[model samples]
Target: MDRVLLTKKGAEALQAELKNLKSVERPKVIEAIAEARSHGDLSENAEYDAAKEQQGFVEGRIKELESHLSIAEVIDPSKLNVQGKVVFGTRVTLYDIDAAKEVSYQIVGDLEADIDQGQISLSSPIGRALIGKSEGDEFTFEAPSGEKTYEVVSVSYDV
Candidate 1:
């Protein structure tokens, strides 16, 4: 797999999840499987089936996290000085020209992009449009709702 880009915070979160899965969830599932197996015929046991299914999910997640962490390139936004231009990990405040509203979004890696938190993937249309842009720069991109324009009001890397 290609190396995955992640913010420092994103990498820490993934690490925490991996730790929890390995230390807590994995052991719990193992214990549950053992308990279920002790209840006699495995083929007819609903508990055993459920435990096995849960074990599969837990193990799969463990593997996924491990893979991501192994190839993760953690970037610290606060450590960068991009001279006010919008770059990866920039918290950009924008004016939605068509909607006549103001909003803020942080350009982040796919692993950390949460739309609800105003974090957009660097590959997203708006994120691509905003890259290398400075304050007062206006850019347009085609959105699902049509051509959307935004003016960059501010860019901060205080993250």
Candidate 2:
């Protein structure tokens, strides 16, 4: 499988979910399954059916988390040495020339991209344009509404 890029925080969140599934959810599901089994009448047991479905879902999520964690390439922004140029995990400040406003974004992996939190995927159009750019560099790209231009105001590893 292709390696999945993940920021340090993203990797940590995945790990925490895996731990919770294994330590709490798994055990609770097992207990529920056992209790349902004790009710007898396996053919008509609604509790058993529901418990089994829950088990399947929980196990599936656990497997997915494990697979993602196994293939994740965790990158710590604080440890990166990108100088002032925009790179993966670097927080970039940009000036939208058309809007006359300043916006900040952090370039991160696909899994870590959360626009509401100011994290953008490296494969995104803006992120691709920002990569390797230093402060004061201006670039233009076509947006859905119209052509947009932006100036790189600053780049940093912090936040």
Candidate 3:
């Protein structure tokens, strides 16, 4: 049970999901199971089987969320005192030296990392390279494609 990092927003999102599962989804699955049971002929009840399966899935997810939330280290970028250094939750814009284009990514916890949404996992190669970088700093890392170089153009923590 290693502790996992979470952004404030990411923790909130997980909490919201847990709440929904408990308050709404759990009740719905229970009702559906009960209704399916009432249909009789348990051996041939497809609805009952499906409802039970859904219940199992919902219950498993609830447990997972609870476990993750229990050990989560929620970090709010706004409350940080990092000055201008790039740390967790800092949104950094980089100038791709070879590509000659500006790109930006928000360093987020692993569970909430979505590259499609411009969020990169803190353990990711780019994230590791960008960590502790101040504005106007240049660094290079071995990208999966090849060695890539980037210059830190800006670092921000937007509330």
Instruction: Name model 3 segments beyond 4 Å from true.
Output: none
For model 1, how does the per-residue alpha-carbon lDDT over 1-159 read when each residue is reduced to its tens digit?
Answer: 877988877889999999999999989999999999999999899998999999999999999889988988888767877788998888999999999999999888988899999999998989888999999999999887789999999999987
TM-score of 3: 0.92
RMSD of each: 1.2, 2.2, 1.4
Worst 10 residues of 2 by lDDT: 75-84
Clashing pairs in 3: none
lDDT of each: 0.90, 0.89, 0.92
- Estimate the overall C-alpha local distance difference test score of candidate 1: 0.90
lDDT of 2: 0.89
Local lDDT at 153 for model 2: 95
What root-mean-square deviation over C-alphas does model 2 reach? 2.2
Candidate 1 Cα misplacement greater than 4 A, ranges: none
